[model samples]
Target: MASIFSKIIDGEIPGQLLWTDAVCGVLLDIEPLTPGHALVVPRAEIDHWLDLPGETLAHLMDVAARVGRAQQEVFAAARVGMIIQGFEVPHAHLHVFPANSASDFELSRRSSRTPEQLAQDADALRAALRTQSDGAHVPGEA
Candidate 1:
């Protein structure tokens, strides 16, 4: 059976996508610790983050980093937090969100947002991403 992320990648499910590459895709999280929270997931449905090959893992992190930068631009938080507790889906993914303190990293701290809200956030992050990728001065990149 395909994981939910795979279904999203295959277009079987709707996703507010920000970035897509050969190895991975980034999308907004419906349940977010904060606004601009997103996930960077590999195309391959690997269950465990540690089980991913080194190179693949590195690429995932790189994508997550880029998303973090964009989230910082969109949310303007003190920092962007990353979490890899992959229990929600079988596919390996990294949760990246804007954070002002340690409590912002807690999964229990997440709350649901309406689809409209998530979509708006996704759009904001997408715009920030495009600006950074297009040679703009992205926040959090000193």
Candidate 2:
């Protein structure tokens, strides 16, 4: 069976995707520590970040940076925090979240968003990414 991340990438389930490339995909965390919390996940379901091929890891971070920048702008965060905790899901994923303080980095604070809020947040990030990306389409930009 595919990891849930893979299922999201494959459209088997809905996800608020922020970016996508041949190597990886960035999506919003359904349960977010803060608004604009995003996940940078490899298309391949590697179970551990350390086990990823070096180039793949690099690509993931590069995309994560772009997503984080959009999150920072859209959420007006003081900083964007990055974390890797593979326990919740088998697939290796990097969590990139908008942060106003150290307390915003706590995974224990994750909360679910309503569908309306998710769509609104997605639009905000898409607009920011459109400007940042020089008009390139961010994943699921609509």
Candidate 3:
């Protein structure tokens, strides 16, 4: 069975994507701990982060770091946090979100966002990412 992440990756389900490349894509989480919360996921379906090839892991983090910067630009948060707890979904993913405080890290703080909201947020984030020094340019401007 394809994981939900895989479905999103395959466009079998909708996603508010901020970045997309050969290795991975970054998208806003419908349920976000913060307004700019995003997920960096490998295009390939790998259940555990540790199981990914070293190069793939490196590329994922590199992209996550770029996305983190974009989140900072769009949200103006004090910091951007990264979490890789793979228990929630079968596919490995990196959660990149804005954090004003440690409490912003809690999953319980997540709130549902409408598709329109997510799309708007993704648009802003993609614009921010494009302006950053090392940020990626997603096709269709994300």
Q: Please report the candidate that would top lDDT against the real structure.
A: 2
Over the full model, what C-alpha lDDT does candidate 1 score relative to the true structure?
0.83
After superposition of all CA atoms, the RMSD between model 1 and the true structure is 4.6
Stretches of model 2 off by over 4 angstroms after superposition: 135-137, 140-142
- Which scores higher on lDDT, 2 or 3? 2
Pairs with steric clashes in candidate 3: none
Tens-digit lDDT track for model 1 on 1-142? 9988877766689988888778888877888999888888999888999999999999989888889988888888999998889888889999999999999987888899999998888778877787778624222232
Superposition error at 31 for model 2 (Å): 0.7
Output the lDDT of residue 82, model 2. Answer: 96
Q: Give the TM-score of candidate 3.
A: 0.91
**Which candidate achieves the best TM-score against the true structure?**
2
* TM-score of each predicted structure versus truth: 0.91, 0.94, 0.91
Tens digit of lDDT per residue, candidate 3, span 1-142? 8888767766789888777778888878889999879999998899999999999999999989988988888889899998899888889999999999999989888899888888888888888887774454474532
Query: Model 2 scores what on Cα lDDT?
Result: 0.86
- Which ranges in model 3 have alpha carbons more than 4 Å from their true place? 133-137
Candidate 1: 10-residue stretch with minimal lDDT: 133-142
